[model samples]
Target chain A: MMKSKHIPEEQLVDYLLGNIGEWDAKQIKAHLYHCKKCQYLLSDWQFLLSQDHKKFQPSQSMKDRIQHSINQMEGKSFKRRTVIGKPGLLFATIACVFLIFYSVHSYYQDINTRNYEIAENDEIPPETIQSAPHTQQIKVTPVSEFNQINGYVWVNRNRNEMLLEVDGLEELINQDYQLWIIYMDNSIDHEILPTQNGMTRMLFRDIDVDEFKKLKASVEPRGGSIEQTGPDTFIVEFQ
Target chain B: MSNDQENIQLLKDIAAGSRQAFDIFYEKYISFVYQIAFSIVHNHAEAEDICHDVFLEVYQKARQYSEEKGSIKAWLAVKTKSRSLDRLRKNKPLLIHRLENLSGSKKMEPGADLQFLHSLEKHLIVEALKAIPIEQREAIIRSYYNGETHNEIAMTMKKPLGSVKSLIRYGLNNLRKQKALMQWVGIDRGEKK
Candidate 1:
């Protein structure tokens, strides 16, 4: 009976480097396939080469910098903001946006309750969009376990028109998703109510994307509230 | 906490929302990853950013990793390479840190593994490596520190695979004898090796 050949160390290196002849490499491969010891040793060798000796850590400042970067990247999808700086613009804009939002929301509610009919004797007045229509696409991700609300947002600049597709959000019976837009400079924010059913097809011409650094959705009671927070809050930043 | 799987386990924990796991995993590999990034980008700040971006991708896209398909090193190496090449062009830098909140996780939560591994008798480990012969030291450093595979180490060292393996095995054995490391990392450190 022929003895199985053990692979030579030089041959193994040669094989790894593609320096061995074809026949020799094939023979080495055949032997290695049958050799469990070689495989284990090889894996250890692989481990050693790839191990971090804790040799050179990026400075602590570097770690903080990197961690901060991770935090920021993570920050984009879901973060809560306090009314930090000047409050005048933030409050005024939210009020105005919500006012328009209520009008549109009430208009839709009345239309639905009236069963989609515009009777000849109906007392409702015709509505007009005061601004030109503009649109921007926005996407969101889950902030935390509770704030898993995520979806698409659309803003029409100048037209004050906005639409939200609350893709992953599950509707709560008494809850609503309030949309908020915050400027990058922390100068102001605009808040509005989005149509439920994933904010689908509702045209809001008031909210502008470029005016905000981030878009937020906070779950609140029906009819909404001044506070932009609740059991769930979601955020996404403009790239 | 064993060979090969420790890193995979760390990543799995990160996916499972273990902030401590993420901390240790980065602690374990940041230097190695940074080395790869620096080697390519040749700029400290850029390399740091590249390293930051790579881990950020790993954490954010953890679900994308199929344990059945790939290893973390390969995933990170690829990400680092890709992100580094991206530096050749223009890309928005990601800022994850709150410059205001620079306090690190120096104070570990009780039962946090990072409590041990964070500092982990760092001086002893460095000293242990220094105690070994330069040949074994270089082999171990490349294999363990730089994360070179056996073949890569051999290519770099101009040595045979068997010799590279022997050098590392011996270096690791000598490193394990450091009582300070034994006390600090505990026995699992050697066992993992």
Candidate 2:
């Protein structure tokens, strides 16, 4: 039986260097495939040469700089997670949603009802807006500085009837609230009515809404005027 | 807690995004990591940059670290060495030939099973190198630290290629022997060869 011949230990370095001939390199590779001692020797050389002995001390300032960078990163990441992880943030979000919904609901209710209080026992007009078919609703939003006032005008073009409701105005002595209808042809028609306790509701017949361009309300003298003489309370436009 | 257990816990905390754990980790291993970087890069500013990158990477990739693979110190040392080498390669593209020879010649495991020594005991490695004869020592240092090919080393030393290879083999054998003796005697302090 032929015995396997191990490559000389020193020549293993030559094999690594690629300095050995092709045939010699092939023999070394084959011998190393079966030899543990030769493998350990090769590894020892690799490990030992790869090591460094010189010592160094990094400046304290460098350490501080890196720590500062890390702190900044941590702070930013914490802030990012605060929106999801912090209970206070959840409460703040809920509060913001509630405030927005409340504001929207109040505005809607005020626009729809115009704060017009109808006592339970108050008699409904024989031809009321609710019973009138094909009635178009118009919201009368108060002018600037008259935010406390609100009104609505409902027009039933088919029946030639209209209903006007106003509320939340400051009461004026010896004055009546008046409604003015401006026509598209620039002609104006006016009506005056007494308001008890800052509210008034009136119904009219023989109205043609197709001729109307705008509706405005204002405080006027006791009998009424050909033109407005007091501050405007609310203004609404008809499309 | 044992140092190993503490290090593992620090890694876990760092993975979980604990800045305090990172601070402790930086204090604990910064010196060791910096030493390895400086040894490979051989410049203060460059080494410091390497340390910064390594620490950031460790923070981000802490979850990838497993005690089953290796010690934390070894992981840090390997990271520093790889980063330093990348810097060295970028700075000196001409060294590619030597680097190729280096990679071809020494195919040790990615992170070898050898225990990673701390900075305090680094001088012992210097001592081990010193115990070897001067010719073998020169060949080994030129091949490893200077990134010189064996032929380049042979030309520089005015020695034959065979002699350079022999010197490297002998130098490594001697260094390993000296290291084993030191470990056995428990005399970790550096001493004159």
TM-score for each predicted model, relative to the true structure = 0.31, 0.33
Candidate 1 lDDT, A118-152, residue by residue in tens? 10101111232222245556676667764555566
With candidate 2 superimposed using the best TM-score fit, by how many Å does residue B17's alpha carbon deviate from the native? 2.1
| Model 1 Cα shift for residue A208 (angstroms) | 32
Q: For chain B alone, what TM-score does every candidate structure achieve against the true structure?
A: 0.44, 0.49
Error of 2 at B172 (Å): 37
Top of the candidates by TM-score: 2
Fnat, model 1, is 0.14
Report chain A TM-scores, every model.
0.36, 0.46
Please give the DockQ score of every candidate, comma-separated: 0.07, 0.07
Error of 1 at A161 (Å): 34
Look at candidate 2 and tell me the lDDT of residue A6. Answer: 47
Per-residue lDDT tens digits for candidate 1, residues B1-193, read: 5655787787778866677888898888787678756544445677777777677656644544544323455455545644554453222121112110112321422222221122223433565688889999999888767898999999999999999999988887776676544433243443323
